[model samples]
Target: MNYDHWGRFLAQKVNEHTGLDILKWKNEKKHTWEALSWPDFYDKVNKTALALLDLGVKSGDNVAIWAENMPQWLVADMAVFSIRAVTVPLYANSPEVQAEYILHETESRIVFVGENEQYTKINAIREKLPSLKQVIVFAEPESPEEPDMSFETFVSAGSFANKAEELEKRRRDASMEDLATIIYTSGTTGVPKGVMLTHANFAETLRTHEILLDMNPGDTSIAFLPMSHIFERGWIYMCLNRGMTIYFNHDPREIQTTLAEVRPTFMCTVPRFWEKVYGAVNENINNGPAIKKKIFNWALKVGDSYYMNHKRVKKEPGVMLKLQHAVANAIVYSKVKKKAGLENAKFFPCAGAAIAPEVATFFHRMGIHLMIGYGLSETTATVTVNRYYDFNLASIGKAMPDLEVKVGENNEIMVKGKTVMKGYYKKPIETAEVFDGEWFKTGDAGYFGEDGNLVMTERIKELYKTATGKYVAPNYIEAKLAMDKYIEQIAVFGDRKKYIIALIAPSVQAIKEYAQKMNIAYDNLEELLSHSGIISFFEDRLQKIQREFARFEQIKKFKLLPYPFTVETGELTSTLKLRRKIIFEKYKELIEGMYVD
Candidate 1:
């Protein structure tokens, strides 16, 4: 894959796919889809690059973007790339201290924010960040003042093309080695370290994905995941490289509606998103009439035979089977898919954590392509992803083209690839510790299967040892139990303890429906969870889910919390991975009580 300047590359794509809608967003007031053509996107990006130049943003300088997914956010990112500057993205909901730490660490000259909420957070800590000079707000603020101007104003200042030559020169002199982004890892412990990625890293990744994935120029994708995370950021870069129309989902709460409206051909999401979908579908199926259940089950069986048995193996189904599939799709599968807003889904990549095999199978059976993959922030998003037809629900599939993957000492999954990060920004000692020669130590324990597919066993650091000398992989247990409809989040703990125990945040709405059906009495959430019926119900569900686990690995006891773990509560990272140590510390008392014999 040859590297080219982002400006030139985007211009080429625009010329090739002229009049195509490259960017889209829903106008809340107008209640319609607003679009930007490829030419419009190219024009906006160029103007934004000039605007950054007008603000004295020089090459190699770091610019912070503290905003949610929006058309302007991508515009800013491309502009930063065109100017040969580094983009340091902070999660839109980043707490004040963490946001301040990144700005101060990067010595960012300017930060672009989304709405007033993000602007307010930056405002409160701007005084503490001496290097931060200007704030460009994407949305109009209640009171726009000095040093804090609207994004429109920032773009208009460049409309005169005052710094056009400077922007052009910067793009002309752009190098593949130039820092593309400094992504801060949302660590489970210790301070976040910035993973430095270069244009070469992104270029190689795009090339590999283009070779492996079958996406086309006219395909449509929805951007819902926070772009600060490498998974979404890298995927979006590839989406644009393919000239796909991207719908920016500004409000995550409206994703379901947006999905229905857009009927996107492609999107990327974490396992948690699918877990909710699985739980909800099961809930609806279970609550329906007897005939409905019968039809749904038969359709799924036919779908499994057609998709998994015949289609996946490249075997043509018989005439009877083909007829059954068509009937199933018409009466059952189509309605279910249309209701879930995935009727038009072509390929949906799921990553960040392990997805339940059942969940993956369910989506596949319904003809919603859920491609499960594995990687970390240091790996530039995907090291391996399940292929279109030949995929195993039990494995994360083979490594990307031209990438090396091997299991080293201690069963650590090591990767050597052009897509890997340059290094952790300014953390030489930390970076040195993670690498052994040319291979990057992924810190994940996995081994290549007989079929040459990688099956991740556990995060080496997350293994828990009990007092009885039994070691447990928390992620394994958690992923298995997360399939239950009642569990929203869980943290397994047993290190140096007598037995495995857990802190569970049950699905409140599901439980409420359960309560109503079971005729349970309760006035509030606290009372409902404490009811003996609810307790017994959870115990039964947990036991059923962990039936295959060994005695030592099974969770012996658990404490249910009234609320779910969240980013705001410091229990989960921005990517929705559990901060186990933080969760353990916060629930120490409850965890200790569960271990009492």
Candidate 2:
């Protein structure tokens, strides 16, 4: 392994440990899984790097990748870094205008796309882009498209044999100061800003999270989230640095099936994935026959108690209980684990949003380690994660070894560490505003718990004041409300209006079971959701859940959405946090209707 740069050198060492496949992907057409060994991966990256050099992509140039999680995406990103170029990643769900703005703003000379879907977006704005020189697509073209070449042609066309010396020189010249990536924020408010992170920023994160990084050669993970997002990108890189095989999921909707097939040891994702899993579990238990329901509940109750006690004090259950647990595991809990692909999973990392403590505990109770942490794009990845056997569900965990975190004014979590970014790219004024001298203001409001773990409260900007001057932290309530299995997704609205209200997306499957049990008639989702029976059920549940809150904190009224909030619909970020303004504006009338006389 060569210590050429603060980053790539470490990956070289782990890749040499095992000669197994570095990347594994499914061929949808062939109905088979395909893999790229390290040698094959290196060869591809070499060709891609040469191809970029051939196309006049000089050192330190900005190149963007507009694609999902795929082998080509990783190859292109590596190829860019090999020549000390900055890799800009555009979200696959980004609209044409947003993509156009990012490409134009970054002044990227070259861009790589996945297929026709991305090609169409670029083609629409190609004429408007002056800095963009070429469009290289991965998949074969369906139609006669100008100014485009297939991924194969782009690689084979490069002549790199004679320029080996030049490539080597570029690699040797890379330093910690070199910009590695410029990730744009998933803007829930205004325009998205590009966060410029250096190689050192990334390297520090990998080294700091070294405990979780002890993945063996047999460890595998599914890259299902947007690789463009720093959270997923950093986790995938960690897998590579630990000699773990990576399985790429092209379509995130099939992540469940993919998980079952791969039986991955680790997966880093947002809280929404687990929330859905919890909802499904509840649905199954609620819908099963009376005896089956009783068995499932008994198993879960025993498992939960065993794990909680085990984790807290490292104690073992008594023989009688142990035998019962074994029987329950064989009868019910084993099925639960295998169904969600956690049967072989050693652990999981969930971040990018505040995960409800109940959800985190639910997994821990079932013997799956769900490490819910906190991070932002600016920090490059994870800032804090629950570690060891002590599953502290309330806190995001103690800060990483070298990082320093403090509660600044308004309870903002202030940070000063190596992992913080150089600053937002080309936005000096905004960057300066976010920092109080050396400490970067995280904008998240929280205080350190008595146990010294960081308890993330909510986004400071999301703390709203009502017309009557009663302040409410929506995320605090939202996090608690998300724990209910019947609630799929919810947006707690009532900023300057009156008392609290909510925009709810109920768990359709769970609601279906409820309807069946209660003998409520419904044909479609719209009918089920509109029925008075289910509405009253949710209303009663909401009241009970918010019983601990102040009078003003309780949700007064709510609107039930027939569909779930998604990134494509501009209601959720890639990590599943609510896009507040978009949801508010989109459903402005519904919110107003709730307050009508």
Candidate 3:
């Protein structure tokens, strides 16, 4: 816990601290888990560092990790930092082109991946990457050579007595000013930009985050969120700093199942994950028997009344309300929470994007704290977070200690703090453009509430003025509509147009269920979705959800997409956020058709 001028925090913690527990992960067969004790983890890091030295990697070099959240990812990250080499993380879902651009841009010397798919992707382009000396895969490689090598072999290649002494010397030589990592932003618009974060940037954020949230000694967490993201990466580091047990979830699709097993104290996530959980819970309720449905609804009503009285109403729940809640929890919410993998969760930080107000209230009613915080990758994962004691779900909460926030021109949120990135990697022109004096332009627009809590708002760049010069924030509309059980993803389109319209991607599972009930026949998802009855159903659902929004914000028309936006299709970023620019352009015809008649 030393906050001296500059030092290797991870190494210091491992060496100085005793009784550190193991990091757990499922073995290759997925039947059971393997664990790494602190001493074992420290040894892996040392070996990895020495391996890098064998690869001719030097201080200040960029090394990339293209994998999911695993013990090796953490080991490689700490190893790279131990030698003062920069760590660049690539999204596991990133295509070859995107991965190639970052690897080439950073001039990465060594790259590590988790599995075969990533290895194949990198191997396909290895010829183009002249500077990439070693491509290390977590598992055993088919053949160990200059281009492709197994991680175990890479570690073994570094087994030398001299390397350990050299590592110690390099640790002492490490400076806070040295570049620690290049975290790529989730490019929702154009190409992804690498944000340069220093050891000081991480140290400052870690120091502040430790104060904002309290994690107990034996608290555990499952990291299903993509580790390539700054949000997950920072959360992982924060857990490490707290001596919390970490569970590595190889597949995000299995989060619910894994959650049931891990029963973690907390998990960090995006609003979309909560949306799915809410939808699934509701779907089960809807499909339940009459008696069960009655109990579920009644339980929710009682829970909401009790929760609101305690949370927003600032009133103690009467004895009757408390009793009702206790019965409700025993029969419904508690069972649902336990099955959903959030039973032990104290609070999970929900950020990366805006959450629907209805969904936020839903979790709160269920006695789950979806702490709707806010931060960009450039801010080392968080600038503002909703604290446990004082928070409004509607707001992104107050800024962290030592952070300065102000509203500048156009109501754009400006921030200045130690957690802010040094600059965009090797892009001074772009870096200078984002700064206004000392404050880093957040590119988001919002106003402080009367209580001084920062209200989360739409990005300034995304605010579109219609043909009548009446500006509308598409994200606000999109968020509201996305809360519907039938809706999977939504994009509002009224920019320079007469009336607002939307491109909707209805939930495939929900649609399938509806089709079966209505006796609608179709061969494929597209055909099923395009049925007249299905269209009518969505029209009704859309109108109902739109009632929550202002008249102008309501969607007059919409086009239902047969398929959801995906990262592989270039319609979404690695973080699962819509690529608005790509989506708008790709669906240009469908959008124009909505306005035609």
TM-score of each: 0.97, 0.93, 0.95
Candidate lDDT (C-alpha), each = 0.88, 0.84, 0.83
Ranking by TM-score: 1, 3, 2
Model 3: runs farther than 4 Å from truth?
Answer: 4-7, 15-17, 28-30, 143-147, 287-294, 311-321
- Candidate 3 residue lDDT tens string, 471-513: 8899888877776788988988888888898888888887898
The pairs that clash in candidate 1 are none
- Ranking, lDDT, top scorer first: 1, 2, 3
Best by lDDT: 1
Q: How many clashing pairs per prediction, in order?
A: 0, 0, 0
What is the clash count of model 3? Answer: 0
Query: What are the RMSD figures for all models against the true structure?
Result: 1.5, 2.5, 2.1
